[model samples]
Target: MGNETNEFDRVTMFGADWCRDCRRSKALLDSLGVDYEYVDVEADLSAADRAEAISGRKNIPVVVLPNGKHFVEPSDAELRGELEAAGVL
Candidate 1:
């Protein structure tokens, strides 16, 4: 599932619907106007593996930021910080 926020321009979210962190991250990203496409780890095995390869963890809510970096279960504060740092917030 996806909800678009125009400010981010680009965002790739790696997660599962069942994950609370994923839910929180998505909510924050949306509230902050961060548009993103979602990749569900459970529903999409390939993405899950790829995310694991990069993060070395099976955790949900692994966000691929617009600048081409990854964040593993980052907190709301962290996401806000990143958005501010990227000048999107």
Candidate 2:
């Protein structure tokens, strides 16, 4: 499906296709029907560095929420909680 705008504005996820956690998080977000920008670190040469800059760690699936809060490799429950808090769930 196309990534369209939604209540969760400016939500960006930096991840790679090969990463299991990234896939899980992506699926969770999609299943929740929230709009998010997905940047594949493997496709973009600098995306890894950008994700690291946001979370201060070299990890895939750096999820940046609309509130400017970010999570690195967050669990499903943690992600859901944040999304609920942001009124997106």
Candidate 3:
């Protein structure tokens, strides 16, 4: 997932292309028809640090909501809650 999203109330995903968890997050978002913006830390230093700062781990699939609330390695249920909260679902 790159900085290519389609919905408003941007959901920013900070991850690398090689990350499976990131891929899972991307697939989930796509299945929900909720467009989310993606930032590749592999290419952007800011994104890497941002994800690290929020998650406290170098874990992939760190998702930042429009309001700047973040989720680290969240489950599908958790992600659904975020989508609902953001009125995306």
Candidate number of the best lDDT: 2
Measured with C-alpha atoms, the lDDT of residue 45 in candidate 3 is 85
> Model 1: residues >4 Å from true position, as ranges?
1-9
lDDT computed for candidate 1: 0.75
- For 6-89, candidate 2 gives per-residue lDDT tens digits of 333677899999999999999999999988899999999898998887777898788988777788899999999988987767
Q: Least accurate stretch of 10 residues (summed lDDT) in model 3?
A: 1-10
In Å, residue 12's CA in model 1 sits off its true spot by 1.0
| Segments in model 2 whose C-alpha atoms lie over 4 Å from true places | 1-9
lDDT of 3 at 22: 82
For model 3 the local lDDT of residue 30 reads: 85
Question: Candidate 3: which stretches are off by over 4 Å?
Answer: 1-9
lDDT of 3 by residue, 1-89 (tens): 22223232688788888988888888898899877788899999888887787767888878877766677777888888877986768
The local lDDT score (0 to 100) that residue 72 gets in candidate 2 is 86
For each candidate, give its TM-score against the true structure: 0.80, 0.87, 0.78
Q: Each prediction's Cα lDDT score?
A: 0.75, 0.84, 0.77
Taking the tens digit of each residue's C-alpha lDDT, what string does model 1 give over 1-89?
11223333467788888889999999998887877788787887798997776667888787766665667889899878876776656
* Model 3 C-alpha lDDT versus the unseen true structure: 0.77
